[model samples]
Target chain A: MRRPISLALAGLLLSASGAAAGPERVAFPAGYQDGFVRYLDVDRPDRKIKRLFYVNPAALETAKAGDPLPDGTVLIMEDHPVELDGEAPRRDAEGRFIATPEVTNVFVMEKQPGWGEAYPADTRNGDWDYAWFDAAGTLKHSDPERYAGCFNCHQSRAGRDFTFTFFKYVEDLKR
Target chain B: MGRCLALAILFSGLASAGQAAEITVGMAAADYTPATVEARVGDRLVFLNDDSVDHNVFVPTAGHAVDLGKQVPGARSELPLGKAGAFEVECVIHPDMHLQVRVVR
Candidate 1:
């Protein structure tokens, strides 16, 4: 009886395809409420900041939006390190923090990508190292080169509260 | 109390020390290397500008995104790993130049 049952089981196994687990969906932790990064021309002596904008993750939906972003939105920008003197805390006409040219990149922590989880704090340990987009809304590998472009831009904000231009989003912070 | 304070100080130092790791990812003929890397929590990735042109890096995610902006030859850029999971790095100017980095807690 045991031999007959064993034979039947083996036959069933042979007929079946190896069960392969589906792709793992990663859940990034939640993102910040709303913020924008400011880029400064650190290369100059006066620490002249080029511009300031709000980073609105929602804008991804309308990359071609014409009007200014809604409240509680963030703006993203990219640039290189600028030469300047001591840690000058400069603010723009809008009262936002000015980022130095050394600030190569900028980002806003308003929304999380639907595919992945919010960045895990314990993982990268407070470093803005990389960028990604869940194009397919799946946690699988996306384009790396595209992501690298994003990283290089954000590297300049390593210091200054680990943020490039959070001061610009003063209204967002109040929320 | 003294012992507790000392332990707190030590822990704070370790937490804020910002431990970093050097990783090379890019194409040889291309202007980048290692394009992407996987690291544990509390690690860092160093991008060395091996190419003649300048390169910028940034992320588009919440809380963990950055922009290295641009760098010239022989200049090195550093990024801190603040979270777990996969992130992308790219060059804004040379859209073709790209890389990926993964951090695990």
Candidate 2:
């Protein structure tokens, strides 16, 4: 079930396990989405962001409604800006924005049994860690401070296992 | 009608506005006081961070999402709730600090 790790993420993880603890624990999803299932789509304003949310099969199988996601769950968010005419997006007859096939940004969130042990309580998302990548699946940040925000931001969702969308994924699995 | 179409009609157009008020949220002890709030659309949220370290305010709920990134201690930010829905707000830096907002017409 383990795939080849991204070289950049692997290098960071090597460092994290030794001394510098950070999001190095997270790996860029293989093929940007291998072994992940797309569960939800969100449309934003202005830019018409059509976000495709993918969750690891482990999460789908083990998750229960209104409960925390199982450990080792990996969630990937892929941003596909809607096709636009001028500043407004062109829609089909149903008035739904059409998302471009090209992904603009990707965010990865993963949870393990002891991943948060290196972080302090204030910045730990339980055992979850976050990493960001560009369309080409290249890690875009190397600063420790940058990863700190990921933990801090997701802290609010502690009641939901520190995730904003895992419940929706569980709901999707039900259907 | 489909669920999406029903929701589209529900959230579309200007949310009803009779009286708009400001709600204050205090961040201290690495937590948001009154973690759950029930308010009306067109209301404004003011966040005051009194925690020792820096905190943040981010809402990624579709049309109303806002990111007041990297808010230092003693900082304040305002967010206008323009839509009627249930959404979650987080400091992003702290796991225990979260705010649940339910805005109704």
TM-score for every candidate vs. truth? 0.36, 0.57
Worst 10 residues of 2 chain A by lDDT: A1-10
Q: What tens-digit string does per-residue lDDT give for candidate 1 at B1-105? A: 334433533443354334544444432344455444667666656666656666665454333445566567666666656567775565545545657667776
Looking at model 1 chain A, report the run of 10 residues with the lowest lDDT sum. Answer: A20-29
Candidate 2 clashes between residue pairs 3 or more apart in a chain or in different chains? A152-B92, A152-B93, A152-B94, A153-B92, A153-B93, A155-B95
Counted clashes in each candidate structure: 83, 6
lDDT of each residue in A8-104, candidate 2, tens digit only: 2322442333533455557787763667877666555434677778888877888887777888898888888888889976654433467888988
Q: Which one is best on TM-score?
A: 2
After superposition, candidate 1 runs with Cα above 4 Å error: A1-175, B1-20, B26-28
Q: Pick the candidate with the highest lDDT.
A: 2
